[model samples]
Target: MAQHVERQRYWEAQQAARQAERLARKRARSIDWSAALRPVEPVPIRTETLIAALASGLIAALLLGDGVGPGLLIAAVPAVAAAYVAARAAGRRPRPWTLVWGVGSLALLVVPALRESAWPSTLAILAAIGLGALALFGSRTWPGVLLSPLGLLEAAPTGVRWAWQGVRARRTGNARNVWPVVKAAGVGIALLVVFGALFASADAAFADVLGGVVPDVSVSDGPVRVALFVLGVVVALAAARAAGAPLRWDRVTVAPGTPRSPVEWALPLVLLNLLFAGFIGVQLAVLFGGYGNVKERTGLLPAEYARQGFWQLLWATVLTLVVIALALRWAPRSGPRDRRLVRGVLGALCLLTLVVVASAVRRMDFYVHAFGLTRLRVSVVTMELWLGVVIVLIIAAGVFGARWLPRAVMASAGATVLALGLLSPDGMVAESNVGRYTEQGKIDLAYFQSLSADAVPALDRLPEPLRSCALRGINDDLADEGEVPWYGMSLGDRRAREILRERPVKASFETCAGLGTFRSRSEY
Candidate 1:
């Protein structure tokens, strides 16, 4: 019986080992190790790429603007030019689509301008990001559109490899140039071994002279700067290469070409319509129910009553966009009446969403009036304005069967951003805040003090001691006239310096409390 039990245990152990071996074999089969062994082709450094690299570096060094006025407006020109040049390099004629790419580059250039305009950096950053994705992938259907620039991130390893190859080539070239010196040093080392020993043995003074000839360079921040320079070069080169050769549309596709069965779309959308209608009814009450009644009903503060609706409306707007996109992309071929019914429902939803947008804008206005102006408040107003435009476009598409709806929406958005870039954001903010202060006399001096040089001209419009004091404060802070290189020169800062130098703050420049926008938009 003991022998039989031992035999059973041995057989079980063997069975387990065999199972483990089989599992390992299965896992190995699942992987394509051929890719790991395959060599990735290097991105050849051509004349076009080299030119782009130089331009990118120069732009980075020069066109990087601060919270200076329309300095970004000026900086944006080169970026657009670069994109146009790059698009041309792709051996394509300057098509209208290439011009769209130019607009994207312009959008990037305006980020700083938008921030300097008076709204926060977040708005500008988001515009640049969205436009960047559009420029890269050329506004394909969903999922693929989202993956456009993110795909660049996925190629991080490839970028790193290209960068490494660049560095290696540079090092190899440098080594060739220094080879003679290295060879001479080897000979000198041999001579030193043959003669230095004799000289040191003959006289200790000769060894002392040799040691004195070698000067010790002290270690400091030099290495850190060198590392930063290297990092900048690598990053700029990578970005240049990518931008010059943007992702081809064919390479990134979304199959919105075919429609799904009508049955699959109809029921889901009908259910959505019921849900949205119920939500809209609530929104209607929120809009006209009066602030006090809503406050009492909800048991919230006046500010809370006002602040919460904008976000809800924003979500509704986004949801509407998603639904419309879904319907357009996947709804199957239907009879005329069914299609008409679907279109009618979608149109009603959009119209209702427009009402929601209006309510949101109203709530934001109430909140701002109650509290004060913030970047977020101002940015939301701008975004909602854009959302309203989108809804109008959607309605147009549905009503007129406009095939250009998507492109129009995108183009209009780009146009709006450029419009903002042209406007004085900082000046607008300052003007608004100053006007508010006049009405209520609630001034945040610290906030004003932190305002960029762009705000100086705006603050100049304020009356008396306030104007003089603010001007002096700004002048004193931006007092240091650092070495102004031709590159990295900020027009706004330069203007501030000039104004400070020219005016020197006389008591006479002060005026009455109320003043309209005194400077032209360009000057601000």
Candidate 2:
């Protein structure tokens, strides 16, 4: 009986110990919601930091008021410089890679100064700024790069709060150095105004020169300028805070998906590889056999054949990437054999997808050759080329391991976009159409009318009524542009103005009326 009682006590003690451990684990796993929800304290603003932020805001308001052009780069300079200065002052040295990205971002602003097209310039600027933000505030991970834009949005409120804190501190007499600078600036401005006015009134030529040099400020632009100033201040403060204390996205861990058995993982991939292989074989046949073979087999014209499958093949390539990602996620990693299986199967899949990418690109090229290049054609071809690059990167990762894959992919994308901006898609399209017209005696003057000022030089090469019709819209736009400040003029805009000034479009409406209506039957 005593032995039974001891056993019962032992069992009870064991149960009690297990319960305590479970409780401890539960506590460990539970998040403190209140602490997470609490607002973060704003970093204290130094006098120099406040001054830099204000100056950046003022510069943005003045320069950016004219719109995106050289002024954009001019405004960005002070904002980026201020951020770097603030970071250094706070003892936070930026990484060399981050500085590289920052410089790239600044260089991207040149797109606006160089290109008149809205879409390309806008995309480049957004990408540039986003990359800069990611470098400064985001994690080094791929997901972090994508989500970094959210960090900028969140920083808006923080920036406002930081600016307000600075204002309050100044009101509380914490910034004694600021008052002296403000007084000195006021005195300097007053002296400049008095002397400048006297000199201007003293000479008519001097007055005219002064009027030409100074920008006209109107009350109507007050709201716009204020908004621009706020934007500049907010962006600068965000960069400063991010450089000082970046978000700890690197600390966020993603749990791997449940691992599958080797058979379960390998089977689907093997089938996919076989399918890709089959499609590639057919593509090879079509490629070597040429358009005659396509026409005979498909009973479709070369252009029709190209157009019919290009989009589908492009989607197939994209979906193949998605499939590869999923396969990687659930891939078996239990043993050496499984690892080798992964490498081999995924490697084959990537190789086959590259062929598919090539097929898609070829189809697009054939179509472009037949129908001439348009914006959509150029865009899709560029996308296909980038996808090919991504496939190559994936293959590299499979061989070398994937730790650097995400970053490499992002960098490649940025480089591709930068290249596209530099290449000038509109100019390329116009040039292609011109060449097609020269060879085939077929042109799409109406389509050319839709192009931006980037097309002017190429369109200027066209003969007679075609040239006049193609240039009409651009010429009208330039004519209405009036006298813009140099900062407001893009390279494309300036060049187009010069070209039109030298050889103006002189065709009447009646002459150009029926000219643009010529459309190829295969266009649809």
Model 1 lDDT per residue over 425-524, tens place = 5656677778888899865444555456666766777776667655654665666545333233345556666766766665433341222112222210
All candidates: TM-score: 0.62, 0.89
lDDT of all predictions, in order shown? 0.58, 0.79
Candidate 2 regions exceeding 4 Å error are 1-43, 194-213, 517-524
Model 2: per-residue lDDT, tens digit, 1-524?
99999999999999999999999876765543223322244357666666677777887787677767787887777667766765676566767767667877887888888888887888788878777776776456766767666776766677667768778978787567677888998999899999999999999999988876665668999999899898888877777666555555554455789999989999988998998889889888885477788888778877888888999988988998999889988999989988899999999999999998888888887788788998888888888999999999999988888887866786777777778888888999899999999999998777776688898999999998789888997887777778666677789888988899899998888777777533332334
TM-score, cand. 1 vs. native: 0.62
How large is the C-alpha RMSD of every model relative to the true structure?
13.0, 5.1
RMSD of 1: 13.0
Global fold similarity of model 2 (TM-score):
0.89
lDDT of 2 at 139: 58
On TM-score, the candidate that comes out on top is 2
Which window of ten consecutive residues has the lowest lDDT sum in model 2?
Answer: 31-40
The residue-level lDDT of candidate 1 at 444 comes to: 48
Question: What lDDT does model 1 reach?
Answer: 0.58
CA shift of 169, model 1, Å: 10
